[model samples]
Target chain A: MVEQGGGASGAGCMGCPLRQRSEWCVLNEEETRFLSRHLKKRRYRAGETIFSAGEPSHGVYCVASGTAAIRKGNAEGNTVLLRLAYPGDTLGYRGLLLGENRRYGAEALGPSKVCFVDRAVVKLLLERNPALGQQFLRRIARDMDEAHDHLVRNATLSNRDKFIHLLRALMNRHGRTATDGGHFMELPLSRRDLASMIGARHETLSRIIGRLEEDGIARFSGRTVYVARSHWLLNDSRPPTLLD
Target chain B: MVEQGGGASGAGCMGCPLRQRSEWCVLNEEETRFLSRHLKKRRYRAGETIFSAGEPSHGVYCVASGTAAIRKGNAEGNTVLLRLAYPGDTLGYRGLLLGENRRYGAEALGPSKVCFVDRAVVKLLLERNPALGQQFLRRIARDMDEAHDHLVRNATLSNRDKFIHLLRALMNRHGRTATDGGHFMELPLSRRDLASMIGARHETLSRIIGRLEEDGIARFSGRTVYVARSHWLLNDSRPPTLLD
Candidate 1:
C-alpha cells in the first residue's frame, strides 16, 4: 500500500536517534519537549514519494530509518536526483521555514519511517531558541554549499568521472569492507536514479558500468556492487582519464 | 590601485535605502540602531574583489549601491560566476553565521558601495530579534533555490539557450525600457565575466554575442548592448534549437 501521507503514529520522540545525536538534530530540553508534542510518525514503502514538488509544507520530517532520494526536475522536464537523505537527516524545513512550496520531491528508496513536526512549533522554537536557529542556518548553509558543488561538478566532470564520484560517495556512506578488503555494498538506488544523479541516460549508465566491469574496476551482480579498484575510484592525486 | 579591503566611510546605515525599504532589509528600529553603531562603509572599484574564496569572513556585507559578482571555481580550476549581488542584497552572512570559510568570492561588477556589519553584532541582533533571523533564513533559501535552478539549467539547456536565459535575467534585473519599447542596459560585466556565469569559455561567449548581433537579435557596441529582438530572446513558447 502506498501511504499517501497523513498523521500516523509510529513511535515516541523522547529518545529518538535524530534528537539524541548532537551532530544530527540538536534540540534542547524545552525545544525537544515542544517538538515531541507535535511529532507524528509516518511510514512509506519502496518507491513512495514522501512529498511532491509545489506541495505545501506542513513541517520538517526527520528520517529515522531507510534511505530516500531528493529529486528535482529541470526546465526541460528531465528529472535529476539531487541527493540522498539518510537516517537522522531532516527534510522540508527549507520550504516550511521559508513559507514556500516544495521545490523538490522526496521519494523513498525503500521501506522508511519518518517523524514530522508542525511548522508552528518549529517557528516558535526558532524564535525562542537562538541556538536552534543557528543550527538550522548552518544546516541550510551546508546544503547550499553541496548544491553549488554539484553545479560545478555537473559542468566540469565527464560522465565517467561523475559516475565514479557518485559511486565513491555511495561507498563512503554505505560500503562495508569485505574480508578480501574490497568494498561491497548493495546500491540503494536503481540504475535510472544513478543516471539521473550523474546527468546521464539510463542506457549510458549501463554502458559505463559494463565498461568499468570489463576493465576490472568494478563488479556488479544485480543491485550488489563491489569496487575491485577502490584505489582507482578514489584516486585524488591522478585520476584515470576515461573517455565517454 | 586595488582596494585590498579596509574600513572606509561611504554612507550611514540610518535612513539608507536598504534599511528604509522593508522589502529589502527588515531590521526593527532598535535592531537598526544597534547595527548603525557598528556599520562601516566600504567602496570598491570595478573588478575589485570584496571577498575571496577560503578567506575568513569578518562580517556581513550589505550592498548599499552598485552591483557585484559572486564567483566560484570548479574542480577543474575553471572560474564560474555564481551570481550577481545587487543593491540591498546581503553577502558573507552565510560564511559568518555558519562559522565557515568563504566558499565563493565577491567582486564588484562596477563601482559599488557596501556597508559592513560585524558578525558579533549580527549574532546579537539575530538573538534579540526573531524577524531578522527569519529574514536571513528567507534570503538563504532564495539563494539556494537560484543555485539549484542554475544547476538544472547547466545540465539541460543548450549554450545558446543559456546565453539567452542569462540575457533575460540581466534585462529583468537592470534593463531600462527604451523609447522604442526595447530593453536597453549597460553591460555591467565584460565578456569574460559573462562567460564564467554561464559556464562557457570567453571565446565562445564572444562568438555567441557576435552571432546574436549579426542576426539582429541583439546589438553590442563595446560595453553598450541593445536587445532589439527582446521578444526572440524572451520567447517562452518556443526556443531556438541551436546545436552545441
Candidate 2:
C-alpha cells in the first residue's frame, strides 16, 4: 500500500536535491514550475508495490529517496529482479513513451518516496521544452548501455563472480568508504531479491555467502554487507576494455 | 573488413523504405533531406566486424538489410550474443548518447548493408528537429522494454522454453507464412551464435535441437528452422499479461 504525501509545490522543485541531476537540472525555471504543479508525492513502506506488471502506465515515477526493485514475474510464479531504482532514477517512462502496458512490476525495497508526473503532463512539458526530451533520451540510452552490460555478465560470469560484481556495483552506488580501506553499505534488497538479481537460487546464494565469509571477503549482518578488502572483489572481475 | 558503399543522396532518403518506419517516418522532409546529405552506406561480408567493443562510437548505424549480432566479450575470451539487429534497427546510438566507448561489438551475420549518420550531423538534426529527438526517445524506450523482457526470460525460463521463445521471437521478426500453415524462416545466426544468444553451451543447444526434431515440433535444415506447428511453440511460454 502507498500513502499519498503532500503535493510538491513549485518551490519544492526549485529546491529539490534531484534538481542537481542532469535530467532535472536542464529544466528551466518555468518548466520546473509547471512540473511541480502536477507532481504528486507517494510514500511506500518496505515491500509495498509501487506498480504491477501489466498495469497501464498512467505516469512516470522518479524515486525521491531509498530504493525500489524492478521485478518481472513469470508464469511459473518466479520473479526476476531486473534492476534496482535509486534516488534520482526514473521509472515507468519506458511504458509511457512506448505506449505499452507495464512489462514489469516495481516494489519498494525499503521506506521510500517517489514523485509522479502524469503522462499527459510529461508530454506537454516535452513539447514545450525540447531540452527535457533530449535529456530523457540520454538517460534512456545510459540505461540501455547498463542493460547490455548486465545481459553480458549474466551470460558469461560465474555465479561467484556475478555476486562479487553485484556487490561492487552496489558499493559504487551506495557504499561508504571506511578508514580501514574497506567499504560498508546496507543492502536494500533481501536475500531472495539478491538471488533473483544474480539469477541464482536462494540456497546457492547462501552457500556462496558462507564461502565469502570463510574467505573474509565480506560479512553479512542483518541487511548490511561489509567488505573486508574491497579490492578482493575485483579479482576475476572482467578487465576494463581498452577504451575504458 | 568494412567496405564503403555509395553515399546516400538527399533524394534517396525521400524514397528509402526505412522512412516508412515510425522512427524515420517521423522525420519531416527537410530533416530527411539533411540526414540523407550526411548518410554514408557501408557493406560488410558475413562474419565481418562492424564495430568492436572499446571503440569510440563516431556515429550510429541503421541496418538497411540482413542481420548483425551485438556481442559482448569477457575476460575469459567468451563472447555472449546480446541480441540481433534487423533491418531498420539503429545501432551504436547508446554509446554515442552516453559519450562512452562501445560496450559491445556488432558483427554482420550475413552480407549486409548499413547506413551511417555521423554524430555531428545527428546532433544538428536533433537540434533543428524536436520531433526527431522525441522519436528517438520512443525507440530507445522500446528497446529497453525488450531488454527487460529478455532478462526476465533468461532468469525464469528453462533452457528448452527459452529456445522455443527465441525461435518464436525470430519467426515473428523474419518468418514467412507458409502454405502448410507453418512458418519458415532462415536462421540468420549460426549454431554457435544461437547457443550464445540463449546463454547455453553449443552442446546443450544441439541436444535440445535434436529433442525438438524428435518431438516433431521444429525441424532444422542447415541454417533454417521450420516450425511444423507454430502454436505449439507457445506451450509453456509466459502467459500474456492482463495489459497485453
Candidate 3:
C-alpha cells in the first residue's frame, strides 16, 4: 500500500518493457509522458495483497515484474482463484471504471513491482483519447466473456476435460517451447493452487493428472508442466461451433 | 435472425418504454432523436433464437419487452444458462464493444420484442458524449464484477447455498411483492431451465426445493414461486467478508 511517486526517472515508467509489448500500454508519446508524470511505482513481497475486496477504487496497477493472483470469495468464506495475471498485465480497471468496491482481491505471487496510475489521471486520459477508452472497454468485455466460458465449463465439462482445458489455457497464456518439441509452462503456484483454479479437490486433481499422463496428454513435475502432445488438448479447447 | 429494418416505425424505438428506464438509454434529447431514426424493433417467438454464438457483432440489442436467456455451451457441447435479459436490459454490448465474436447465444424466453441499434450509430453517439461512454464503461465493469462473483459462487458455495442464493438474486432482480407480505416471481422458463441455471440435476433440484419448502423458506407452483420470507435469504446472499 505504500506509494513511491516521482521515481519514474529511476526504476519506474522510464523505458519500461511493458510499454513496448503490453496491450494495455498502447499509449502515444503524449500519453506516455503523462504517465511518467503521474504513475507511482509500488513494490510488494510474495503473497502480499496488493488490494483487497471492498476497498475503494482509487487507481489501477500495471504489473511491471513478477506475477499476481486475482481471487474472489464465496458466502462460505472460501476463496477461489479467478485468474493468474502475469507481468505486463493491468489490474483494477473494473473497480476504477465502475466506481464500485473491488469485487476481487489481488496479491503478488512473488516479489513484484507494479506501477499505479491514479484514477483521476486515468479518467483524464480516457477523456482525451477515446481509443484508449475503447481499448479498456474491450479488455473488460473479454474478461466477462472468459468468466462466462468458465461457468459453462464448470457446469458441463467432466473433471478430466476441465483439467486438460486448464493446461491448454495455461500453455496458451504463459507457455514456453520445450527443447523436446513440446510446450512447457512454469506456473507461479503449486498443484493446490491449480486445483482451486479448476474447482477440483486435491485428490481428484491428482487422479486426473495421473490419467492424463497415462493417456499421453501432459506431464507435470514440480511447478513446471510439460505437454508432449498438445493436439488433443488444443482440439478439446476449441469451443463448440455455434450453430449460426 | 430476420432483418426488417424499415418496419421500425411500427414496433421500434419510438415511444419505447426502455428509452425512459434503461441506463443504456442515458442519452441527451439529441441522442434519443438519433435513436428514433436508426433503431429497428423486432419480435421473436418463444423458444426462438435471437442470436447465436460466433455471430459477427454488428450492433447491440435492447430488450424492450419480454425476457431472453443468454446461454453458452460447455466442452461437452451442452448449453448452460448464463443469465436472463429482461426489459430495460441491453444485450450483445460485450461483443460489440470488444470487436469480438458473440461469446454467448441468446433466445426468447417467451415472446420478446427487442430494439437493435447499429454499431456505427452507437460509436457516433459515444464520440459525441463522453459521459455516455463512461456510462457504458461503468455498465461493462459492473457486468465483469457480477461475472467474477458468479465464478466464486460456483466454485466455493455448497449446492444448497448456491440454490438459495440464485433464488434470492432472481427475486431481487425480477420478483414482484405478493399481497401476503411474501415475494412472488413469475419465471418465464420452467423447472428444467431453473435446474440448468443452478447446475443441478432435476432430481436434486426437486429434493432441494422440497427441503426448502419444509423449512418454510420458499414455495414453487407451476411458473410462479412465492417466498414466505426474504430477510434470511438476503442475509445469506452477502458475499463473505474478504480477508484483507
Candidate 4:
C-alpha cells in the first residue's frame, strides 16, 4: 500500500486493504491512480454533521474508514436514521438524483475518513469508462435494493423483526469479527440512535432489547451488542399490518 | 393541435381526453412531425398485463390513451399495487437506470393505447438534443419525487395513513369530478386491487374503505371513488422525515 501521499491529488492508496476490500471501492491500479487525483480525503469527528438534508450537494462520498449514519429529521424534532455508512459505502448519490440540496442529514459516528469525488468526475468516469461505471452502478443498485428492503420492513415487519433486521443489517455491513461462540460487529450507535435507526420509539426499543437479552438472543455492553442466537428470533413474531 | 400531416403513428384514439391534454405528449405540429418517426403504439384490453416485474425492460412507457396500474408480486403469489399510471406518466426508467427488470408490474385497467420510444433513439436524443434530454430528466426527477414520497409513506406512515395517502395521490393524479358535496375521482381499482395497491389484505381494505366512507372523506360508487376531503389526508399525515 502506498502511504506517502495524503491529499486530494495523491496518486496512492493502491493495494490498501480498504481499497481492495470494498465492493464500492473496487478501483484497479490505474483507476485508483485516476481517482486519487480527483478524490480529496476529509475527516470528521464523532457526532459531526457532514452534510444536512437541504444543503447543496456536489460530490459523492466514499467512506475510506470509520462510520457515519444518514438520517432525516421531522418537524416534531423526531429524527430517523436511514443507514450507518461504513468503509467502502458511497454516500449521497441517491439524494443527488433528486436535485439541489439533499433531503437527509449525514453525521459521522466516530473519527472517520471520507473521500469526496466531485460529481462531474463521477459522471465522467461513469460515462468514459464503462467497466468502472458498471461496478459503481452495481453498487448503486445494491444500495437501492437495501433501501427497498428497508421500505418493506417499515411497511410489513413487526417491531421485533425490525430490531432483528436492524442488527442483521449492521452485522452484514460492518461485522469485523465472528468471535468464538458468537459474533462481534464494530458498529457505532447508541441505544437511542439504534431506535432512530429502526424507527422505533425509545421505550419500545428498550423493551425489545430487554426481551432479546432476557431470551439470550442478544447481549449489550457499551455500544456493542451480541446475539447468542439469531435464527430463532424469526419466530418471536412476524411483521404485521398494524392498521388492520 | 395539428392533424399529423405526412407521417402517421399513435392516432387510433384521437378524441381521448388524456391523450389530448397529456403533459408528456404535448407535441406541436413540427414537434409531432419530429417525434412521429420514433413513436410506436400498442393496444391492450382490460385486465391485461402490459409488463411483468422481471422482464427485460427495454424503454420508457407512457400511456398514450388509457389507464394502467403499476403493481408488484411476492413469492406467495400475492400482488401489491404501487400506483395507477395514466397518460403523461412515464414508467420503467428507474429499472432502465438499474439495468434490470422493472420493480413493479403494469396492467391495463381498460383498453389502452400506449406509446413506445426506442432506447437507442432516446440515447441519441439525449446526446444530440440536450434540451429535450434536460426536459426529460426534469420529468424523471418529478416522477421520482412521487416514488420517493410513496417510499416515505411505506417507511414511516401507518397502514391507515397509507390508505389515505393512496386515495389522495389518486385524486391528484387522475381526479375528474369535484362537486360541492365531495370531490369525485374515477376509482381505477377493484377492492382487491386497492388492497394490493396499499399493501393490505382485502378484508382490511374493505374495512378501511367502509370507515373512510363513514368518516366523510370519500365514497365509492362502482369502480369510481369520490374523494373530496383531501387536505388533511394529503397534507396532515406527511412525515417530517420527508420534509427533511
Candidate 5:
C-alpha cells in the first residue's frame, strides 16, 4: 500500500540528494521552483505495489531512496523481473509520453521513497526547457542500450556467467568493503527474486549458489552474500567453470 | 560496403513516405525543409556493414527502404542480433544523444537505402522545434517498452512459443495474404540469422523448423515461411506443444 508522505513543501527538489547523481536532469531555478511546488512524496513498504500493469499513468515517479523492481506477467501466468530501478531513476514517463497504459508493474523491493510529478506539470516543464527534454532522451537512450545488452546476455551467456554478472552488478550498486578485504552486502532481493532476474529456475539457482559456496568464491548467509575476493568478482573476465 | 547515393537534391524529406508513419516525428514545413537540406542517402548491399560497433556516431540514420540488423558481440565472441530496423525507423540517435561510441553494429539484412543527417543539423532542428524533440522522446519510450517486452519473452517463453511469436511478428510486418487465406512472406533473414535472433543454436533452430513443418502450422521453403492458418498464427494463445 502507498503511504502518503508530506508534499514537496517539507523537503523540496532544491537540495535533494538525487541532484548529485550524474543522470539527474538539470533544472533551472524557475523550473525547479515550479516542479517543487507540484511534487508529492509517497512511501511504500517492501513488496508494496507502486504501480500495476495496465494502470493509466497520470504522473511520473522519481526514486528518491531504496530500490524498486519493474516486472511483468506473461501469458503463461509467470512473472518476469525486467530490471531494477535505483535512486534518481524516473518511472512511468514512458507510459505517460506514449499515452498508453502501463506495460509493466513496479513494486518496492524494500522500504522506498518516491516523488511524483503530474502529467501537466511534466509536459509544461519539458515544453519550456529543452535541456530537460534532451537529458531525458539521453537517459532513455542509455536505457535502450542496456536493454540491448541484457538481451545479448540472455541469449548468449551460460547460466553461471549470468549469475556472476548479476553478482558483479549487485556489488557495484550495493556492496561495501568488509574488514576481511571482501565485499559484503545484504541481498537486495530474495533468492527467488534473484532467480527470476537471472532467468534461472529456483533449483538451478540453488545449485549455482551451492557450487559457489563449495568453490569458496562467495558465501551466502541468510539474505547476505559475501565475496571473499572482491577484485576477482569485479574484474575476472573468465567465470569459473561449474560441473553442473 | 556503403554505396554513396545522390544527395538530398535527388529526393527529399518533403513527401517522403516515412513522414506518413505514425511513429515518425511530426515536423513543421520549416523543420522539414531544414532537415532535407542536410540529408545524404547511402545504399548498402545485402550483408554490408552499415555501421560497425565502437564507431563514433556523428549523426543518425533513417531507414528509407529494406531491413537492417542491429547486432552486438558478446564476451564469447558470438554476435547477437539485437533487433531489426525496418523502413521508416530511425537509427543511431541513441549513440548520438549520449555522445558515446556505438554500442552495437548495424548491417544491411538485404539491399537497403538509408538517409543520414549530421549532428549539428539535427541539434539545430531539435533546438528550434519542440514538437520534434517530444516526438523523439515518445519514439524512444516506445522502443524502451518493446525492449522490456523482449526481455520478458526471452525469460518465460518456451522455444516453440518463441518461434511462434517471432512468426506472428514477421507476419504483421511483412506478410502477404495468399488466395487460399494463408500468409506468405520471404524471410528477411537467413536461417542462421533467425537462429541468432531467437537465441537458439543452429541445430536447435533447424529442428524447430522441421517440427513446425511437420505440424502443418508453418512451412519453410528455402527463404520463405508460409502459415496455412494465418489467424491461428496471429491469435492462438496456446502454442502447440513440441516433443524435443
Candidate 6:
C-alpha cells in the first residue's frame, strides 16, 4: 500500500494555487497547458509519512494545501525540525534536483494535498521549455539564499533571541497582528517543535518562553504566545550578553 | 561612475564560459572576438579591498588568479566571511544579478587577478541567449546551497564543535597534511579573518583553538594549525571533551 501511487502522473497543474506565481505557472497559456498535462495531484492525511531519510525516491512534490515539516535526527535520536513548508513550496525536490537519492525525512503536518512530478516528467518539461526550467532554477536559488542567511543568524544568535527573531520572520511572512501590548503573531509550532527548530531542548524552550513572559517581552496562554513588545525583540538595543 | 558603462550591452550568444554547458553559455565566436579585443586583466595586492559592501554598481569581476575573501557583515559590524574565492570563480555578481546597486563587500586575501566584464555587456548577453542566463542562475543556486547548508550546521552545533567541523570541512575541500602528532592543513585564514569567516569573536576563536590543542585536538603555530587527531575531530565523539 505504501508505494501505490494515484496513477502514471498528470493531475495537479491547471487551476492549481501555485499556478499564480510559481515557475510552473507560465506567462503564456500554451506553456501552462503543456505543463498541466504532466502534473498529478495527490493527498495525504496528517501524520502520514511522505518520505523517509535514506529512502529510495519519488521525485519532487509541489504542495497545494495544508502544511508539511522536514525533520532530521542525529545518531543519538535528537531531532531537528528543518522547515515548516506551506503552499506554493516544493518538497523533497532538493534531493531530486541535487541528484541525491535521499537526505532527510518529510511528513505532512496536517491533511495535505500535493502534486507529484517524477524525474522523467521534469526532464521532459525541461526539454520542451528551457525557459520554464530556468524559472524553476531561480525559485530554488531564492530559497537557498534565504535558508543560508537564516542559518548564519541562528548559529550566531542566542536561544531566546533566535526564537524571537524566528517569530518575527514568520510573522512577517504569514501575517502580522497589532495587539495592545505590541504585536502578537501566532507561531505554527508546538513548544517541543519550536524547541527543536531553534536547536534547544524542549525544557529549555519552555524556560525561555516563561522567562520572556516574566520580563514582559512576551506572554503565553496555553499554546498561544503574545508578543508584548515587538520593537524590543527586533532591535538589539542594549543587547543582552549571550553565553552558550 | 555608476551609469558609466559601455553604450553596448553584453549578451550570452558571445564567447562566455557558460557556453560550454548549455545554451546558457552560448558565446558565439564573433562576440568572443570582440571581448578579446577589449579585455584587460587587473591585479591587486594582498589585503586590498576590491569593492566594499554598499559600493555603487560597476561590473562583475571574474577571478583570474590568487584568492579573494568574500564576506557579509551585520549591523553590529560582525562579519561572516562567505567563502574564499579562487581562480575561475566569479566574484561579486549577486548585486548585478539581483538588480541591487550594492550589498556585500569583496576583498583580496592575497595578491589576486580578476577580469572585469562590464555590466552593460552582461545585460546584452542575457537578452540574446536566455539559455546562457541559466548558467549565471546555476552559479547563484550553487552559492545559495552552500551558504544555506553552512547556516544550518552552524545554527544546530555548539561553538567549539562548529569550529572543529568547519576545519574538517575546510580540510576536505582544500586538502590537509599529516605531521608527527597531528595533521596540518594550509591555514587559508589569519585568526581574525577566520573568526570573521566562521562567525565568531577573535578572542573566543583564539581561546577555542588553544583549548582544542590542549585536549589533543589541534596545535597552532603562527598561521598553521595541526589538529592532533584529525579523524576524531571529524567525528562527533562527545566522550572526548576538552577541559576548560
TM-score of each: 0.87, 0.87, 0.86, 0.75, 0.91, 0.79
Q: In model 4, how large is the Cα lDDT of residue A106?
A: 84
Q: Give lDDT: candidate 3, residue A78.
A: 79
Q: Which stretches of candidate 6 lie over 4 Å from their true place?
A: A1-12, A55-58, A72-78, A173-186, A229-244, B1-40, B55-59, B120-138, B172-182, B229-244
lDDT of each: 0.76, 0.80, 0.76, 0.64, 0.79, 0.65
lDDT per residue for candidate 3 within A117-151, as digits (tens), equals: 89998878876776777778777777777888888
Give me the runs in candidate 1 sitting further than 4 Å from their true place.
Answer: A1-11, A22-25, A29-34, A229-244, B1-11, B21-24, B210-216, B230-244
Docking class of 6: acceptable
What's the C-alpha lDDT at position A75 in model 4? 43
Candidate 3, residues B158-202, lDDT tens digits: the string is: 567788888877888779887767888886767777777767777
Interface RMSD values, listed in order for every candidate:
1.7, 1.3, 1.3, 3.9, 1.1, 3.2
TM-score (0 to 1) for chain A, all models? 0.88, 0.90, 0.85, 0.80, 0.91, 0.82
Docking level for model 3: medium
lDDT of 5 at B104: 89
Tens-digit lDDT track of model 2 for B51-75: 9999998999888788998999876
Model 1's DockQ score: 0.59
* Pairs of residues at least 3 apart in sequence or in different chains that clash in candidate 2: none
* DockQ of predicted candidate 5: 0.78
To one decimal, what is the Cα RMSD in angstroms of model 4 from the true structure?
A: 6.5
Q: Rank the candidates by DockQ, best first.
A: 5, 3, 2, 1, 6, 4
- At residue B84, candidate 2 shows an lDDT of 90
Could you tell me the TM-score of chain A in candidate 4?
0.80
Badly placed stretches (over 4 Å) of model 3 are A1-14, A23-25, A173-175, A203-221, A230-244, B1-15, B213-217, B230-244
Residue lDDT tens for model 2, A155-201: 77777788888888888887998889889998877788888888888
lDDT of candidate 5 over A1-244, digit per residue (tens): 2333324445567667686662345787677778877777788899988899999988888888899999888767788887899989998878888888998999999999887888998888877876777777777888898898999998887677788888888888989988888989888888877888778887899999887787777899988989876444444334343331
lDDT of 6 by residue, A1-244 (tens): 2121322342335555577756676536665665556556667898887788887666777777788888776555666777877887877656665566666688887888776777887767766776766566657645654665665566366787778776776666554566554665556668888887777888998898777766666677765666655454547422332321
- Residue B191: error of model 5 in Å? 2.0
**TM-score of candidate 1's chain B against its reference?**
0.87
Best by TM-score: 5
- lDDT per residue as tens, model 1, B115-198: 777788787877676677778888888888898788777766666778888888888888888888887878777898788777
